[model samples]
Target: MKFLRDILDKVKPNFEKDGKLHFLHSTFDAIETFMFVPNHTTKRGAHIRDGIDLKRTMFIVIIALVPCLLFGMWNVGALHYAAQNIDSTLLENMLYGAMKVVPIIVVSYLTGLGIEFAFCQVNGHPVNEGFLVSGMLIPLIVPADIPLWMVIVATAFAVIIGKEVFGGTGMNILNPALTARVFLYIAYPVEMAGEIWVSGIKEGLVDAASGATALGVLGGKDLEAASNYSVNVMDAFMGFIPGSIGETSVLMCLIGAAILIVTGIGSWRIMLATVIGALGMGLILNAVGGNPYYDLPAYQHLLIGGFAFGAVFMATDPVSAAHTTTGKWIYGILIGVLTVLIRVFNPAYPEGIMFAILFMNVMAPLVDNYVVKANIKRRLNRVKA
Candidate 1:
């Protein structure tokens, strides 16, 4: 450590103010700070000092996401092999999955960080740590088989339009990862949707296996007909179904959720309210009972599609989500309700959490405003008494 610090100290002067390489200050600072916490401290003004900085906070999120990434890789390989009716060793499965999944992750990080670095250089501002989490998240939410070119384009679009255009990270109105996803989904629906989910399916191995997800199956036909394609609830719960890379596994997402909550990095209030809202909406739909999709079990809704992943991860984004405690509940519940409503009512999009979260991200400030107003009103009433 001391050796590395000495090397950094030697080079650091060149990137400091008024030095020949001063333009690269943000880049140097980003690398140096990532390697070790900054020794510099505040000399003035009130500031809360903590061991955890933005980089460490984002690193914690990355730690939580590791379980999902590993499980997603395994699921991708397992689904691909299952589709072809080919038995594969677990090692083979993971290797094959990694071949498909790792590139997307790499491209996401490289493209996103490249743009972020460019922005920091141009603006002469310190590099934000937000992309550390966003980079991992973009690949996780997309199909493993999505084109590498698309990943590059989407990542660039996310960093430039979604975040940088709005003054970067904390100022962005939408989740940058979701923004990239929504861009791909809308601009290239054919590639983002349909049977493209399962990797190795393009090899044309088996006719018996279908790439239609559980949510797709339910939305596509009546309950009896869908039963032929429906993934068992247990399989969905266990993440054996074909869907988005990381979203198929409710179990993995829950494990990630537990880690985030335990570390105090995630919002439990938002998570709890989101689940209740989804269940509540599902129950309401079940009671209406006109269509087989509506009659589908409420609890099952939480297991399938992107509901679990989005509720645990996307909706709880600290920057885009509601800031006030009460507003978090409203924001999360509305996301859940809207997700179910969109899935059930609009059969065109089988997965709704992406749209739901993006929509709620836009509404989050409005929700917070109302919550704040209410709190002020209550305080005023108490003073009057």
Candidate 2:
């Protein structure tokens, strides 16, 4: 560590003002900080410094995502072989999965960080580590077999349009990862979904092989039909099923959630409220009993699709989600309720968390405003009384 720090110190001068590499100072700073925490501190004024900074916070979320990433990679390999009735060892599965998953992750980081660094150079500001999390998230949210070119386009779209357009990461209204997903979804609906769930899966390879996800099966039929198709609670929860790279495993998502909550980085209120809202809405649909999907158990909603992943990671994005304590509950509940509603109502497309989170991102500020105003009013009334 000391050796690396010394090397950075030696090269730092060249990237300082009026130096030969001054033009790339932002880029250098990004690399340096990533390797080591900034030692420079305030010399004046009374400032309360926390143990962690933005980069550190982003890394914490990345740490939380590690379990999901590893599981997703193995699951991809498992599904790929299972689709063709090939029985392979765990190492073989992971090796194949790594070949597919790693490139997407590389493209995501390179594309996003390249754009961010370029913006920083042009804007003459420090490069924010915001894309660190978003880059990992993009790869995880996408299918393992998605084209590299599409990832480039979607990542560029996410960084430039979803984030940079709104004045960089902290200023963005929507989650960049979800933005990339939505872009892919809208631009290439056929590629974004369906058989992309499994890598290199051939058609009619076996009598009992299907590439469709649990949610995909549920989209067209009732709970019983979906179950009959082998979409059950245990398989989905354990992530031994076909779905997006990281979203297939509810257990992994919960593990990520635990890390986030333990580190005090993610909002537990949002997580809990989202779950409650989803169950509440699911119960209502069950009461109506108008369709097979409506008959799905409320608890099952948390176990399938991207509900757990979205609730744990996407909905709790600090920048896009509601900030106020009371507002978080509202923001999260709406996300959960809307997700179930969209899934139940729109059988053709049941992956509603993406749209629901984006919609709530727009409304988060409004929710916060109302929460703030209500708090102020209540305080004034209490004083008068």
Candidate 3:
């Protein structure tokens, strides 16, 4: 017992001393002190690390995302049931939905985490839990019926090229989730394109039914309805319409956003800025009497497509997004503007979240550069005065 106590004493720090217990501090301390390298100088004079680490941070995101995920599962089953014209209890429908979505989640996590673990082993560093959120994110952004092998390839590519090659975790330039989506988009154009993907049941197996997405229907419809009222926009907003599994529900995404902001895991500036930018562009189109012109109003933009989901989750990626407050505003606004632009102007892709996020990823560094320079310039001016 004394021997065991001595080992514990050596491995574990006195948390009472610091008044906090950082998630892995004791374990990390043990690994360093006994296993790897002792005398690891605690740099930054940082005392009493918080209980939350990046892993916990990422895990919180996953937890916040649960509502959307559960809703998506139920929705998937609902769509299938509706298509098949079969009587199903809500629970049964949800099970059917889970049958489809769960595998995608499993495959994504397994493949992405496999890569992350290998990299951690090779690099001799502790594993980052960022992929926990990212793995779920990849499937959520993709169509429900995406091929499993494709998921594997995309996950590997995103983890290796999108992240590890640039150096893991905080070093990557592109959002790893977006990276996986982009690779899948380019590599399997037929799969990722909105038209090629199908949500409801197949023709023979179920009752025959066919319906275009609200966006597609609206795009083709006379501009008259857009001006008159919201129309089927409510269905899209509530997530009854067919689209990606998780992204269909703006309300659920907002719930996740609320948690993220409250927890300090995500930036509210980016979230608000994105909504404003999207609304701004949407209102402008309304005023111009353009194709998307409608009395439907600007606020509708927030409920449509993947705008809410992307702004809340994908756009706020700490690694690929702006670190500075000013830079975050700029980055977020551009994403909103670009998302609205793509959704309105491009007839090909109904949702613009993927494009908007990737476009902003490229510009994040420039945004930061200018923000930092402005701060420096102000400091110099102050010194001169």
| lDDT by residue (tens digit), candidate 3, 1-385 | 5775577566466432353554445334434443332443558876886667676798899998998899888887787777667788999978988888999999999999888877776665666566888998988887776778999999999999999999988998999988998898788876675453345533355442243455655554456644443546667678886777898888899899999999999899999999889888888888876454333467877876677889999998888998899999999898888887887777666667789989889889999999999999999999999
- Number of the top TM-score candidate: 1
Evaluated with lDDT, which candidate comes out highest? Answer: 2
What TM-score does candidate 3 reach? 0.84
lDDT by residue (92-126, candidate 2, tens digit) is 89998999999999999999999999999999989
lDDT (C-alpha, whole model) for all candidates? 0.89, 0.90, 0.78
Candidate rank order under TM-score: 1, 2, 3
lDDT by residue for model 1 (1-385), tens: 9999999999999998899999999999989988997787899999998887787789889998999999999989988888887999899889988999999999999999999999999999998798999999999999887879999999999899999999997999999999999999989988887677788656665342478777777777456776455458899898988888988889999999999999999999999999999999999999888877887789988998999999998999999999999999899899889999999999888888899999999999999999999999999999999
- lDDT over C-alpha atoms for residue 80 of model 1: 86
| lDDT score, candidate 2 | 0.90
Which residue pairs overlap in candidate 3's backbone? 226-294, 227-295
Model 2 TM-score, all chains together? 0.95
Q: Which whole-number lDDT from 0 to 100 does residue 313 have in model 1?
A: 89
User: Each model's TM-score?
Assistant: 0.96, 0.95, 0.84
Candidates 1 and 2: which is better by lDDT? 2
